[model samples]
Target chain A: MASRSPLLAALMRLPPPAPVLMAGSHLLTRLGRKMAGRHPGMIARLGPEAGKRLLLDATDLPALILLQAEPLSLRLFPRRAAAPPSDAQITGNLAAFLAMLHGESDGDALFFSGELSISGDTSAVLALRNALDDAEIDLAAEFAALFRAPETVVRRLAVVAGPRLGLSLTRMEALP
Target chain B: MMELVCPAGTPAALRTAVEAGAHAVYCGFADETNARNFPGLNFSRAEMAEGVAHAHARGAKVLVAINTFPRAGDADLWHRAIDDAAGAGADAVILADMGLLDYARRAQPQLRRHLSVQAAASNADAINFYAREFGVKRVVLPRVLTVAEIDEINREITVETEAFVFGGLCVMAEGRCSLSSWTTGLSPNMNGVCSPASHVSYETTPEGQDARLGGVLIHRTPAGGPAPYPTICKGAFTSPDGAGGRQTGHIFEDPVSLDATFLIPMLQKAGVRALKIEGRQRSRAYVAQVVRTFRAAVEAADRGAEMPVGALAKLTEGQASTTGSYAKIWR
Candidate 1:
């Protein structure tokens, strides 16, 4: 193989990656575990079958392995799994995922514009989307509640989260 | 000034719409009584009571949509829906099924009734019939009529007219189609569903990614592409050209959402009482954006000034929007 170009070498010679990405992923995994423990009904939305897997690849973040059984489970993975551990995989960035979950924008529109992609068991993915739309999941509210946020600050956190997450302030008010 | 009536699939969406300047917000309880009856959407009875109080506190009215037609053996469900809507303090209940409308007339005479767009009551005579029989105070006109047609109907009908000025459009006659049922054995009128999630499937093939509705091919997009949901009317198909050859394309409608924000003036001049936005199945963000934009537009219209519609281009279906029957090209 030819030696790397000087420009390519320069591009590769960037600063070391941040320690926060790994730390954030660990924190989120813990939160996911807690949420899973509390909301078994949400996992049932996947399907009736046991051992159904959903691989969620949030582009800028760590991939998540979700097992959709009677008790749904989630874990963050450092790299792509060697085996296909999912019937379906939904790939999107945080904004796209937030838009999808919050109904902040049209999922079809997002998918059409290539902001989101679904591979494998389309029906299962559709079921998940419909389920999410039917229900409300406010991250800021859950966070606020978990932290025992002051009532005044909870509303403030929700208002700040609305535009950033493409959610309505009204909807965010109900989060806590 | 014309009122802005918006759809709220959930209580959060309802509150968001009201806060964002919706004069009225319509929602359904978490059941089959409403047309936008999708999973994880709509409200429970407690949620409804809270939502109504919230809207009323904001000086906004709440319209409960019991618009889905009552099934033969399930009349009691819709009957109870109307009763519950009234009990929950909804300003009015939007009804479609004639039998249910009649039920509301007799059972809750004090509660106001609006004929739902699901009734597809386009003509003055049809609208007048409902007004005379069920004492309907308003009619949520279908997306099929032009502004001129609406103006004519307004001149003849005694009840107020509500027109959908924004969001999704059904190309078929509202409340009268069986296309979804023919494919899925369920429909909005019968099962309170259309192109329901259970019947939709997608697959990746050598050709591309194909979406199917009830096992029939609807649309095919390239691999790793954006495949629009296989909503029947917005799906693509290949059919005979009448001359023997075949043609493949979107036969009914290109996947486009309706955006009549520019036509607010004409609709108001046509004597439309309320401007409705469709998307009860949307998020509170979407509701707030649309409501906020329309509120500005309606306020601008009151001042006889043109208001530019802002960044809603991203919220439309397929990134394309249409006026959809308002200008009457179909006529």
Candidate 2:
């Protein structure tokens, strides 16, 4: 038989689905909530704060749109938000989010460079920085393990492609 | 007999080195306060305190590195690190930032402070300036200096000197490069992360493969070839020359580690106090093996025995090493 793809081989060897997804989703939710909570004031300013709807267009396959609030949750929003007016538009991919958190990329630059965008509240965007500064998300162990994982090829590819697409889209969006 | 200081990124690594005869083991909080801020590495405040106690019990000292520069308007975190290190019974604090060094010297006059290699004290004048102004007791010399330069520095300065003997190397002048900042906006001086993993990615493409960091294409290896990490200085790029020729491949350095094992006697004669081994991200097994090897070498040098042949060839990256600037050819 043809050798199973490396990623497939790795995934198949995983100890079943429920435990893996549960653990992964739990980590994601906890980190997302921690990030959101750390910048409560900023999170509040993004729309109504309590019920603000934000869209994160990852610009990658299996594109993700996140709706963030007091209790943070993530879902794949299909067909985009139809003129419903999002408080902010976080473009780019997971790498951009990671870079922004690491203080490597500023929100303003991300927005101006079209790596990220915002429409409803500029003050809300500023608040995001404040929140990140006040909060600490520990992803070192998780990130290290993820990098060492054999199935990391998919995510790694996305990390490389995401920023390229985001930058290109940002430029295209900026053109008249 | 000057003290031989070494690096330890984890508690297990610290204990391993201390047991294997490290006179001093330097570490940092599991955060940006240290240079080797790799994931799943470094010590917690409590762990540091415990490690200090253990090292002290074994007659070894613990030095804390708050080496990275403080961000603009965010000096409190750095200050807290200094206070925490002092409270944890650290033997000394290694610092790089002028402002932070000044702060530590003033705020805690009793805390012994050493200048970090990140400060890049390549010359005697700079070393003397830091010693005289900030009362720095020692200066970890940057890897760019030669044995003669180190001897010259010792002759001119009262402070002790330290140098790296093994592991990874930096080609750029420390504290000066902004490559990471230019691409990622996170300054290594301020953020203490170099070529942070968050911005790095490896992808397989029909046109071979690519490794990129922060959206910049750093390397493209052919299929079935090894892809080195996208460290900015070691990236492959095409620089068009004014003479209408283009240069490709590692404008700075090839993907190789530094191994200066053959230069120990020369370094000792040049008034070197400590020899550092990098790689805080390495396994405890790796740390134990390296510490044991170096410990034996140091002992052999003290007894005037013939130096042992190299035993760490397999541990080096890409199975290659360089004497780096210690031979002075680059200068």
lDDT winner among the candidates?
1
Per-residue accuracy of model 1 over B1-331 as CA lDDT, tens digit each: 7899998876767877888999999998767888876656677788899999999998999999888987787698889888999999999999888899889989999999999888889999999999998899999998888888999999998899998877877888988878788888888776678887667766657876777778887888776554555788888899898999998888888878888888888888989989899888766667878889989999988888996664587777767788888886743
Tens-place lDDT per residue, model 2, A88-172, is 5545555556555543343333432334433343334333443442232224423434345442444454345545543211111
Clashes of each: 4, 2
Task: Report the C-alpha lDDT of model 2 over B93-209, residue by residue, as the tens digit.
Answer: 999999889999998889999999999988989999999999999899999888888998899999989888887778789777788878988777778777775566555467765
TM-score of chain A of each: 0.64, 0.49
Runs in model 2 deviating more than 4 A are: A1-176, B205-209, B222-227, B239-247
Worst window of 10 by summed lDDT in candidate 1 chain A: A8-17
Cα lDDT of all candidates, in order? 0.75, 0.67
Q: Tens-digit lDDT track for model 1 on A1-176?
A: 12334663454343324464356455666655455445544544444433556677766544454545434445455444353467877777655776566556656567767677776665566556655554466555455555667645766766765565443443443544
Q: What is the TM-score of each candidate against the true structure?
A: 0.83, 0.64
What is every candidate's C-alpha DockQ against the true complex, given to 2 decimals? 0.31, 0.03
Whole-model alpha-carbon lDDT for candidate 1: 0.75
